[model samples]
Target: MIYENDISYEIRGAIYSVYNNIGPGLLESIYESALDYELKKLGLKTKRQVVLPFHYCGDQLGSFRLDLLVNDKVIVEVKSVAELLPVHHKQLISYLKLSNFRLGILVNFNVNNINEGIFRKVNGL
Candidate 1:
């Protein structure tokens, strides 16, 4: 068994619930919204469209919006595309690095099997 943090395990269960109900071929926003709802229903504190600002030389750069932040502990990046590329994984890693977060989940709701599409990434773990 793969050991995960409590929040990660809960987020995975929530994602499975959302994907099982909604299936595939939907837009990313659709999955984002649905997953957010499912996560909330599971009693996990969720924040959508959270802004993570970039910095350079102690200067504030632009920011990127995270799809969802669960319990302020895990970053959930939702995607509905043909496939998840390395860039997708990199993007999640970037978010974790920028926010100093330890865990992140990259979920692609475009696969026939949601389990095949879910990815868990850890920063400094």
Candidate 2:
């Protein structure tokens, strides 16, 4: 199994490549598709728009759709909004907790600087 850090590093690289080539001002789904392509081109396994069942205390609740699940280790949440709100970060955190993943990346592709738009969140990483 690939370590979370290694997978994260590759994911970041893919993010930068997608941003550099496409720039910004695209829809979230567009960036999501591009990033998924880039990641697959980089020889990484990815599942796009994955719906993972959510449960609570042994009861089946609703479900959440992850933008991308990389190598089944890292969760990539893509956004293309004017600015990322706290709820966006909180949502990723909640997904990590509910999905039992250790690492996640929240990226907004609507900013001038992708660096500022990228955030890494961990659930006990």
Candidate 3:
């Protein structure tokens, strides 16, 4: 099985590819589409806007939409904001916990430097 770290590495490359080409200040949806396209071009499986079922005490509650799920192992949360807030990080963490996903990449593509805007979040699963 491919490890989460390995998948994350490829994902980082894809993110940079999209950022470098598209630059910043685009809508989150646009980045999402472009990143999805890039990942596919790299021969990686990606599911966009995936609906994750939410559960509560052994009951189905609602659902949360994941921006992108790559290779069925990594979650990619795309954002285009002036700055990434604490809530953005928390949102990815929550998705990781809820989905039991091992790794997640939270990317805010509205910064001058994409390196500073990308974050790798591990769920310790």
Compared with the true structure, all predictions reach lDDT values of 0.89, 0.94, 0.94
Best-fitting candidate, measured by TM-score? 3
Task: Return model 1's CA RMSD, one decimal.
Answer: 2.9
C-alpha root-mean-square deviation, each candidate: 2.9, 1.1, 0.8
List clash counts for every candidate, in order. Answer: 0, 0, 0
In order of lDDT, best first, we have: 3, 2, 1
At residue 85, give the lDDT of candidate 3: 92
As for candidate 2, its clashing pairs are: none
TM-score of 3: 0.97
Task: Find the 10 residues in a row with the least total lDDT in model 3.
Answer: 1-10
Between candidates 2 and 3, the one scoring higher on TM-score is 3
What digit string (tens of lDDT, one per residue) describes model 1 on residues 1-125? 32338888888888889887879999999999998898888888889999878897899978889999988888999999998899999999989988998999999999999989999999994
